[model samples]
Target: MSKPDKTSRHGERRRFSPSMLRRGMNLYPPFLGMGLRVKEFSDDWTVCRVELKLTRFNRNQQGTAFGGSIGAMSDAFHALLLMHQLGTDYHVWDKAAEIEYVSPGIGTVYGRFEVSPEMAEAIRAEAAGGDKVLPWFETELTRADGTVVARVRRQLYVRKKKSVTERERADFTG
Candidate 1:
């Protein structure tokens, strides 16, 4: 896997391509411990698919997937997706997140996070004037046979970084 690109003009944290992100995430200690695998990432970074296999280390007392594992599997992807979509000019963070357990995940469970072009456009428009935008995204975790196991809702805060000129103007105006 290619190293994360460090080409930002301002020398801030470098932006990672999908492949790099996938590889990095797969090696993350928490994810690795929880049996969470980043299965796929779209070239444009709009979609990220993750899987959690039922392993003895991750199973609950009931011999099913643990709830915490379920929630962990759904975390981070939405924020990562938006961060990549918005590029280096913006800051993206996970404002809030929630998960509802609908059914017990028996075997392998998968979660997919996708951001549409319209959603990206809307976020860009909202943040163009230097205002923060809070957008919501939802994803479902399902078993291989299409049994719904959980639904996750994530709220993200996105804001465009003000240029030096814009900051100066704001300071002057204020």
Candidate 2:
């Protein structure tokens, strides 16, 4: 269950119930691929706890996980969080993403994104008007050794697609 957005500055401290996100897999692909478990997320931040599945890895010559897989895990967190917090009636896509290697990525990888209420507000403001892309967000990927494997910045497009009310997002109390 997601908590109500206490700080209204992030547009409106709205909570996109986790159960709702779970039922909407058709809306996201990476979430399906990443198979992430959202530990926690508010309007401003998110923490996703995921294990690096061997099946999803490309063993390098040295047996370390593939850099692309590492990057993908990190990048996917931001997209998942955005959808969970912001609700539907908008479109989101990875505008751009970048990753920096820090370790050998020897073990399970975890991804986290701090969205900040201020940033969320900004995204709402930008998308509230139209379908223009919001500014990019930076998230981090960490290895089991507590080393930063990659830092990713993803640009997103959020727009009010056809005046979505509470029901469209299934937020209606009735």
lDDT of 2 by residue, 1-174 (tens): 975544322365345444444345424665445443444444334444454543343557777777776766655556666654565556666677766777776666676666555565667677876657566777667766678767777777666665556446666655
Deviation of model 1 at 6, angstroms: 12
Query: Candidate 2: where are CA atoms >4 Å away?
Result: 1-45, 53-57, 164-174
- Computed on alpha carbons, the lDDT of every model, listed in order, comes to 0.86, 0.59
User: Model 2 shows how many backbone clashes?
Assistant: 2
TM-score of 1: 0.86
Quality of model 2 by C-alpha lDDT: 0.59
Top candidate (lDDT): 1
Candidate 1 ranges with C-alpha deviation above 4 Å:
1-14, 166-174
Worst 10 residues of 2 by lDDT: 35-44
The lDDT of model 1 is: 0.86
RMSD of each: 4.0, 7.7
Please provide, for model 1 over 1-174, each residue's C-alpha lDDT reduced to its tens digit, 9 standing for 90 to 100: 975455432355556657787999899998888999998887766889999999988999999999999998877788887777777789899889889999998999999999876788789899999899999999999999998999999999899999989899999999
